[model samples]
Every structure is written in C-alpha cells, then in structure tokens.
Target: MAKTKNPTLYLTELDVTRLEGIASRAGTAELDEMLDALLERAAIVTPDQIPKDVITMNSRVICALEGDAEPREWTLAYPDDADLAAGKLSVLSPIGQALLGARAGKTVDYRLPNGTAQRVTIVEIVFQPEASGQFTL
Candidate 1:
C-alpha cells in the first residue's frame, strides 16, 4: 500500500462473506494481503442496508482516470466473471480492489504493472446491484 490515506469502505455482508472465502481459498500472498486490508477496513452491512452511493459487487461505475479525457465504464466482478471485452472487472484486480467499496466522487489509487501509481475518480455509478434490489444469496 502507498502512503496515501485509505478512504472508508462499506461492503455488503454477502460480498464480505464471499470475498473472505476467496481470500482464504486463493492462498496467494498478494491477494491475501490486499483482501485482508480491505476487509479489515470495511464496514460490513446487510444487502438492503448498504448505501446506494457505495460501490458493491457487480456495480457498474464510470471512472475518470487522471489526465485521461475519456472516462471508462466497468462492472466489478469476481475473477471468473472478469471479461475485459465486456467491461467486467475482477475484484481481485488492482483497479478493481480500489473500486470496490469506494463511494461516488472518491479517488482511488492503484499501482500499474510497472509499479507506477495511477488514480481514478469514481465519477458516477451507473448501477449497483444492492441499489437495484438485486441481492445474490
């Protein structure tokens, strides 16, 4: 993690449960570290109790990368559902980790493959599963 202050994270209970299993089962050090950090900092809430402004699993959001004119659209997903062509981003991915639990207007930072930090602003949430009353399990 960078020295930047981490923003408050709000994760649905269901998302936390599934991601906890993934963190334990995956057994990758990087994933474990990131997941642990995120989980530890997150405020777990019920599906219906989650705020509409927070990004939960399967949320479709528009992010504006620093210095980029074009904003990108992404749907946060689990690894199996990640499809770049379909704009589905994996929660385990660097960017996805930052996107998860972030609120609208918050800026998230992630490191690129080359170890350079990149920033993206959570400009708008086009859709969120919880907000739409789509509670999966």
Candidate 2:
C-alpha cells in the first residue's frame, strides 16, 4: 500500500507508552505495522495538552463511513476492551487506528480487510477521557 499524507495524529504520553508496549508484543505483523504507522505520524503530547475535540483512548465518537449516509458511534479502546456488540473498537482494528487522534470534522483513510481503501469522517467526539480530566482511563 502506498503511504498517503495524513493529518498529524496526537497522542497522550500515557497512551503512547502503553500502546508501544502492546505493539512490541503484537503477534501479527499487521498489528505491529498499524501501531508503527500511528506512532510515526503521531505528535505525542501530555494529557493536559490533548485537545477536547480530538479522539483519544476510550473516547466515544460519531463518524460517517465513506459512501454511507448514517453515522456510527464507537468507542476507541484497547484490544482487550474491544467489544463490537458494545461499540468498543480496538485500536488495532483498521477503523480504530484510523480514528485515533483525529479531531472532530477531520477525515481519515484506511484499508479494509479486503484491501479496499475506505474513508471516514469524525463528526463528533462525544466523550474524551483526557478532555474530561480522566487521564488514567
């Protein structure tokens, strides 16, 4: 896949530290690559520096998939916390990785399991843990 210029991703120091450990222990090359990509393009920041509108771990967001009229709500989370039925999306998942650090009103492009390119727009960030001063979450 060709690398495309993406908007700068913002991540908290705590999140980065945890995700780096997860990435290092990842069993799949795809997961490692996804984490690398995210880290490569990320602008690491302190929890207090994170913007309120940016999507962070445990943040509930509303997004519209490309070509889809209806917006879907999801919570960006860790692999162990992922529960599709509950709308918790794993950061290792394509859509989850794509939404990381994205601010409301931004759009991100990602690849599907079938290798199809798809885009999604962040319509709103309903809940951001850091934004709410819940940095430990």
Candidate 3:
C-alpha cells in the first residue's frame, strides 16, 4: 500500500519573514523547532499568490474536532491576540500549528494538553485575510 501524503503547507512571504523572527526568540528549543519544521516545508508565496482556501494569519475557520459534537469557529491569531473564549487561537499552540496550512476538509493531527493525539477537521474556511485582499494584517 502506498503511504498517504500530507497536504502541502503554503505560507505567505510576509508571514514566513515574521515567523522567522519569532522562532529566533522563542526561548525554548521545542517551540523553535516546531516553527522551524513548519517553515522548512512550507511553499512560501506572495500574499496575492496564496490560494483563498489556504489558512493564513488571522483567517477564521470552522473546525470539527473529533469527539466534539458541535463545530466551533476559530480565528488564528498571534499570541498577543489569543483568547480561548473568543476562539482566537494562537499560532504558537499545538492545535493551531496543525491547522496552519491545512485546507478545508482536511483532518489534521495535534497533541492535546495531556500529550495525547487529537484530530481536527477543518470544516470550512469562513474568512482568509489574504483571500479577501486584506494583506499585511
């Protein structure tokens, strides 16, 4: 049997440049490595070149997580803007990392706080800033 290939990760040039700076000052090897892994594999492109379906920074998406009966809306945000109550997920978070470059209908794997694996299905991309021409946000 052929092994399944994961979806390609796409990142805007702007986001990648900024992420590089963040990774440098992450203060922990784990966090730095996580960001590095994502960056290394991503196909970086200009903001206008990114597909609308791709999740960029500040994109709002509806997610259906395994074991959760109701789908929830989450906006991927930087750490400063993260608010679990409002569903503003931080990119530094494990789940957020999983969803970063995944497209709608893709099921992504992330580690739960307890260190167990969990899957999150991206049900829909409600809004992507770059898709709507709101680049640089």
Candidate 4:
C-alpha cells in the first residue's frame, strides 16, 4: 500500500487513548492496519476542542457514498456499541475509520480490505456528543 496524504483527522484525547488500547490488542492484520492508520492521521485534542461539525464517537452523521446520490446515516461508535441494524457503525469498520474526525463538507478516501478505494463525503453531523455537552461519551 502506498502512503498517501490523508485528510487531517482530529480526535479527542479520550478517544485516542481508548483507540490506542484497542489497536494494541487487535488480532487481525486488517484491523491492525486500519487502527494504525487512524492513529497515525489523528490530531489529538481535548474533548472541548473537538469541532462541533466533526464526526466523533457517538456522533450521528449523514454521508454519501462516492458516486451515489442517496445519503446514508450512521452513528460512529465503539465496537461494543455497534449494531448495523440500528445504524450504529463500529470504529473497526473501514468506513468508520475513514469517517472518524471527518467534518461536515469534507470528503475522505479509504481502501477496502480487497484494495478497492472508496470515497465518502460527510454531509452533516446530525448529533455530535461534544456538541450536546456529552463529552464523556
């Protein structure tokens, strides 16, 4: 895989700490790579410094799959909180990693395990924990 410039990703200190632990224990090469990529590109910040428009854990976001007009909504969440039927996306998923720290109006690109490049655009942060004063979440 070629190392390319990734979109600037901002992550809260809490999120970074938690994710680091998760990454350290990752069992699969694919998961490890994705976690490492997320950590490498993240710009750690305080909870209060997280942008209201950025997609953080527990943030419900609306996005568009590149080339698709219909928008899909999902809540970026921890592995334990993820339930696809509920629209809760796990940070372990390729799409979830790509969306982390992405702000509304920005486009992020990530490659699938099969090496297929996918682009997703953040349309809106419908509900961000920090924006709602729930920073601990």
How well does each candidate superpose onto the true structure, as a TM-score?
0.90, 0.89, 0.90, 0.86
Q: For candidate 1, lDDT tens digit of each residue in 2-121?
A: 112453888887898899788888888987788879977777778888889999989999999999999999999998899989999998888998899999999989987689899999
Best by lDDT: 1
lDDT of each: 0.87, 0.86, 0.85, 0.84
| lDDT score, candidate 1, position 16 | 83
Q: Candidates sorted by lDDT, descending order?
A: 1, 2, 3, 4
Worst 10 residues of 1 by lDDT: 1-10
How does candidate 4 fare on TM-score?
Answer: 0.86
Give the candidates in order of TM-score, highest first: 3, 1, 2, 4
- Runs in model 3 deviating more than 4 A are 1-7
Compared with the true structure, what per-residue lDDT tens digits does model 4 show for residues 1-137?
A: 21225537788888877887777776678667776777677777788888788899889999999888799999998998899999999988889988888889999888888999999999889999988889898
Instruction: Show the colliding residue pairs in model 4.
Output: none
In angstroms, how far off is 71's CA in candidate 1? 0.6
Model 1 clash count equals 0
Model 2 vs. true fold: TM: 0.89
Q: At residue 55, give the lDDT of candidate 1.
A: 90
Please say which candidate is ahead in TM-score: 2 or 3: 3
